[model samples]
Target: MNISYKWLKEYVDFELSPQEVCEALTSEGLEVGSLEEHQAIKGGLRGLVIGKVETCEAHPNSDHLHVCTVDLGQGELQQIVCGAPNVAAGQKVVVATVGCKLYDGDKEFVIKKSKLRGVESNGMICAEDEIGVGTDHSGIIVLPESAKVGMPAAEYYHVESDYLIEVDITPNRSDACSHYGVARDLYAWLVRHGMKTSLHRPGCEAFKVDNHDLDIAVEVEDNKKCPRYCAVTLKGCEVKESPAWLQERLQIIGLRPINNIVDITNYIMFAYGQPLHCFDADMIKGNKVIVKSLPDGTPFVTLDGVEHKLSHEDIVICNEEEPMCIAGVFGGKGSGTYENTTNVLFESAYFNPTSIRKSARRHGLNTDASFRFERGIDPNGQIYALKQAAILARELAGGTVSMEIK
Candidate 1:
């Protein structure tokens, strides 16, 4: 389990350093494999700041290069040569000033005064991947306009040297597999040690989601394998880039930001410790889902585009026409959402632990959902998680809840 210090802050307001938290968790039975601070890489990010592109023009000597003058809120504007195709005037970007060192994996890169095809560059403009915050190396990371030009890039990008605690959770410790689970346990340990806590306990137990009465169908063929399955149907939802706050939450946790439809599911799972999957409603054949056991040798394509042959014991969530997902595992490609998808259906359920575990191992596909399911989750609490996803879908994706499925 990789738990981010910043993510834990969202749940608990403890001022303990990452190392301290790791120590506390270790003392409480959760083994910490290692603790690493983001700043430790590349000897730390210093002399990097949020910058505004004052002007951007094509390089005279190279067609693919752009000469950019950036305002760092200082007396002099710094010139940078950028090869990103997205650089534009009036954009907020990362400016790695001279003498700053950035790392890509173990390789060290130093920003300095140099000429890029005859253009004298004072510093280097950076992307998320360039500085290690994310994998988006397509272009320079554009900060929100509210970012102060002179703010430290680490602060602006939230690199605050946050630590990721790599924990070794035993399979029997299913509840501690997620960040919230870890926080909850750590909070307990803190209280037991006579430390004060401002942490709100994980609230999904009584979490309320407004019911939108519409129409959907769900059938669990084997009640023993799938105790309960809930699907939240949405209509008129707009799948677009998530707002900055939502995107930041996922990005800081090292999850790639997709469209709002996908990101919301990821965010809810990231925060609530309940794994959820969203399917494009329009793509769901007959607007009905059936949770059942498929025949052995059934071929199905998961969202990753990998075709897996199903065993007779495999549990699947099928639409009227075909299997939409390997229950408590991954979604199928046929019903996945895309940018143009306006309606969606999110599934939250509890699957038999041993059943999911064997199926996951049989197919050589272990996912976050499978891991949690195989270890067992709060079966009675899944409806609440389903509703939370419903509420978020309405708020973030401009969707109206159409119905509840069981």
Candidate 2:
């Protein structure tokens, strides 16, 4: 399990350095494998600044390239040859001035005067991936109009450095599966050692259902397999990119941020150690979710686009007529959150560890949700986690919650 030092500090107050925290965790029976420094942007985006495109014209020798003059807040304009089709005049962007270093994996290269298609370029426009902040290579990053020209990109983007602590969790230590759980254990140790510190959890007190606008019903067929299942519906969500703060938190712990709806679920899962799933409410036929087993030989495709035949004992989440998810294991291909998912059905449940383990192994799938479910997560926290996810979805994705949490 990877834990971010900065993220952990939010859950528990501690004055220890990253190394000290690792040592304390190790002393408390959670073996730390490694502790490494992590930068939000590789090199902290040093020598990069915000620039505005002053003039952009098609390259004389290339069909897709554009030669552009950019204002770097300096007296002189710098000419750059950009290959991105979206390069345009009067747009703010990130610029790697000459002498700036960019990294591709571990290899680093310096930006300098160069020619592209016979056009002399003095600097380079940066894409998110080129600077190690994201994995987008589609086009040069376009900054907001409010971004000041010539401001340091790192400062403008609030680039941060953190420490990643990798802990080797034992089979019996399932409670230590999340950031909050890890902090709880650390707090226990602090208390044992006579330290005055308190473990804090993200408040769910503000999680009041706004209305019954999108009430999705849930039914659990086998109590033995699933003891508790909590679900809430959210509507009017704008499924765009997550806020920068949430993205940073996920990225700091090595998780790729999807959209707001999906990222919020992932954030709550890692935060509370409860695996949560969100379904596009429009796709839930009959507005119903039934947790039960499908017959043997039933073929279903997971989100990864792989087809699997259902076993008799494999638990599935169905929406009136079709299986929408392999319960606590993986999501179905067409039922999960998408770019147009305006209404969401959030799920937080506790499944029998043995049932989840068998299903995961039978399907040859080892997902984050399955890992925690098969290890037995806190059953009682399902409602709290569900509420927290609903609160976040409404906050980050602009949604209204249903009055009933089924």
Worst 10 residues of 1 by lDDT: 201-210
Q: Residue 62 of candidate 2: its Cα lDDT?
A: 88
What is the TM-score of each predicted model, taking all chains together?
0.74, 0.77
Residue 319 in model 1: lDDT: 81
Clashes of each: 0, 1
TM-score of 1: 0.74
Deviation in angstroms for 17 in model 2?
0.7
lDDT of 2 by residue, 209-319 (tens): 788878778889999999998888888989999988999889888899999988988898888899999999999999888999988999999999999999989989999
Q: Model 2: how far is 295 from its true place, Å?
A: 1.6
lDDT of 1 by residue, 1-406 (tens): 7777877877776768788999988988899999876543345568888899999999999989999999998979989999998999999988899999877677887787999898899998888878877788889888888889889876665555667888898877877777777888888887887887867634433323345654677778899998888887888888899997787667656788989888877776767668888888887778678889888899999889999999889899888878888888778887778988987888888889999999898888888788888888877767767777777778788788777445
Q: Candidate 2 local accuracy as lDDT?
A: 0.91
After aligning candidate 2 to the native by TM-score, how far in Å is the CA of 330 from where it should be? 1.0
- What are the runs in model 2 whose C-alpha is more than 4 Å off? 45-159
Overall local distance difference test of candidate 1: 0.81
